[model samples]
Target: MIFQHSLYHIRWAEDKQILELVWKPTTQDLVAEEFQAALHNFAGFGATYGVSSMLQDMRDFMDYLPPELLRWRDIVVSPRYRQFGLQKMAFLYPPEMAPKNMGNAPIQIRGYAEEFFDVYESATDWLLTDIRPRKAG
Candidate 1:
């Protein structure tokens, strides 16, 4: 019962009890495609009332993510961009160097500040406990 899926969309890795999400928002095709998959997963897992945020590695888009990307509102909150506003606790980890109030994306309005994590595994460990995605043995 290993739920294996690889996409920017959310993945229910039942065996691992982990939901894997990766976003390639730089390109329209990747953004739209990943969002489609993520939305479907969100529907299956419940989307209406969960507070999800972006796991944005801001460094990936350092040069122009602000001017070019933030100019669009939908891009700020689009599923293609990040699976956010889902009402379930989500996370955001800006690059170590990005200033505390750096992101220019409109989602910053969510007011969910980023907490530094030493590593992804550590972050996910905390999320799994907090979110309590069903674990598989």
Candidate 2:
């Protein structure tokens, strides 16, 4: 996906039903509509009838300043969360981003995804499926 915000991990899973896209929240940015549009385009490939995403681990993206660090770009992280939710599946960062505690973050995010989506072999599995024949009048 062409997201303005950086995505932590992205891949296919669960025999292709799950197109997991995990994000580690950083107050550094906001997600835009073009992001979803890009993923929507890529998902058009092949017989993979349906594609969904899993977004998780957003904390920095939601932090408001103490009247100190606040900026215009920081207006509504909460709404940004909703925008990203337009994706098939979206997971939250679950909490804040303590720079000191980032060491174990990846494991935490991946664990959440796997716990929900199960497992998949590869992106290839996401590509090949039975194509539906369009009805001809």
Candidate 3:
């Protein structure tokens, strides 16, 4: 199954039991509202399907996240995903955009296991691992 919004596309990997969200490229930088909308969609989809693993494709995403929104992401967004049983997240970022410290960003603050990959195959393989979801207390 697939869901589409202006900022991103969400698809369910039935065989792999993971939800994949790919950000769409835009000429303008992304705003917090757009990013939040994508998160809301993720929350809704994960809740509805009870999916615990996610693969985020950021290859085509060129927007810069503002500092304030970055804080909200770590403080508010990450926790929400944890509440919805998000256990593992694989981030596929292009090599150019994937800085050395990129994995240390707000996206990794949820306390769930996460890894960054430059290739889709690696990310998908990792997400397909048999690791069970760890519920947040």
- Report the Cα RMSD per candidate: 9.5, 13.5, 4.2
Tens-place lDDT per residue, model 1, 61-133, is 2233344434343344444223434322234444565445322212223233233343565555454443423
Off by over 4 Å in 2: 1-9, 14-17, 24-27, 31-34, 38-90, 96-137
C-alpha displacement of 107 in model 3, angstroms? Answer: 10
What RMSD value applies to candidate 1? 9.5
Each model's lDDT:
0.38, 0.33, 0.77
User: In what order do the candidates fall by lDDT, top score first?
Assistant: 3, 1, 2
lDDT of 3 by residue, 83-112 (tens): 888878888999877757543422344767
TM-score-best of 2 and 3: 3
- Best by TM-score, which number? 3
TM per candidate comes to 0.36, 0.29, 0.82
Q: Of the candidates shown, which would achieve the greatest lDDT relative to the real structure? A: 3
